[model samples]
Target: MALPSTTVADFSGKYVLNKQLSDESKFDDILAAQGVGLLKRKAVGMVSATSDVHVYADEGGVEHLDITAHVSGGFTSKAERLEGRVLNWTDKEIEHPLFGACTTKSKRVLPAEVDAAELQNGWTPECTAAGVIFIQVVPTSGTDWVSKQVWGIEEINGEKRHTRRFLVTTKKNKTVYARLVYDYAGPL
Candidate 1:
């Protein structure tokens, strides 16, 4: 059977984190290169994050996605308009479950166009401006490192859910992968 058609609007709702998995061995080097202390790295590997997503159109018919994510005992929120512009934000320091006080700087690039075909494929196309790809640069004690996050939606067990994948590539070209799976909690 064909999958049910999905639109950006289908993803609007509060989603609670259900599962998270990461490759620890691959993540260690990426964290170390980012100057994360040993203790903090351990803490990062254990923390869980949740997200809420909203999609709407503006007066000019421009599409926007507002996302709020709670992570490591703190929260960060940002909005991306599908106008091909980058939105930047610096968040206040929050108590991290593993790293103590932590602040974050992020840049988000929204899809320039929304393609229904992309959403149906179980992965958001990097070309279409439907989902969001964001890069977060966290400055640690010694140096700064970046984590790239891609957001998408997929149908799981006959229900559509929000998904996020994190990619952290070390200076030496090693890469680590982590994922967060969220289920719909309720309507917006």
Candidate 2:
């Protein structure tokens, strides 16, 4: 049976979801501070939403806060032997409106895997992955709250689209507070 999908929220192209004081320039500074070290591990910052440059508000009077923020901690290597490639992805799944995890793990590469020539000119490491892979870092370590996300697909007229909600929690061990309920329309 198909799931009962009632609402269709389309947050046009994309946007940034900023929390605290980390957005745009400040966000760039954070990356700069990491320098080459960034290639080593994972990092997090304010969710900055960037889209067409238009504002949208639902009938409820709440601003649609859906966005696709630029993420780092994607790929890096040393020793030059194709050690490992990383892919930093977010929770863009709809249905559950619950949680997500690091879909892709740092894996070593091989020459025979894909001709060295192809590797040198491969558009991106993600292109190498064989199947539909989703790389997301599940936020459930010790903190709580991972709700401000969804994955959307457009429709014919590009008016009412479909999307899935993604949120995370630490069992009953709650910490932060967040909610997911909005209608998104790209910038006009």
Best by TM-score: 1
> Lowest summed lDDT over 10 consecutive residues: which window, candidate 1?
78-87
Indicate the worst ten consecutive residues by lDDT in candidate 2: 77-86
lDDT (tens digit, per residue) of candidate 2 on 48-89? 223332123457754333223333233232111111212223
TM-score for each model: 0.52, 0.23
lDDT of 1 by residue, 1-188 (tens): 11234564445776666643223555556667656688877765555545556666567755555667656543243322212212345454444333344455433345443222221234544323554544353435434444665566555566555666566655566556655567667666
Off by over 4 Å in 2: 1-8, 20-42, 46-68, 72-168, 179-188
Prediction 2 TM-score vs. true: 0.23
lDDT of 2 at 92: 35
Q: Estimate every model's Cα lDDT from 0 to 1.
A: 0.51, 0.28
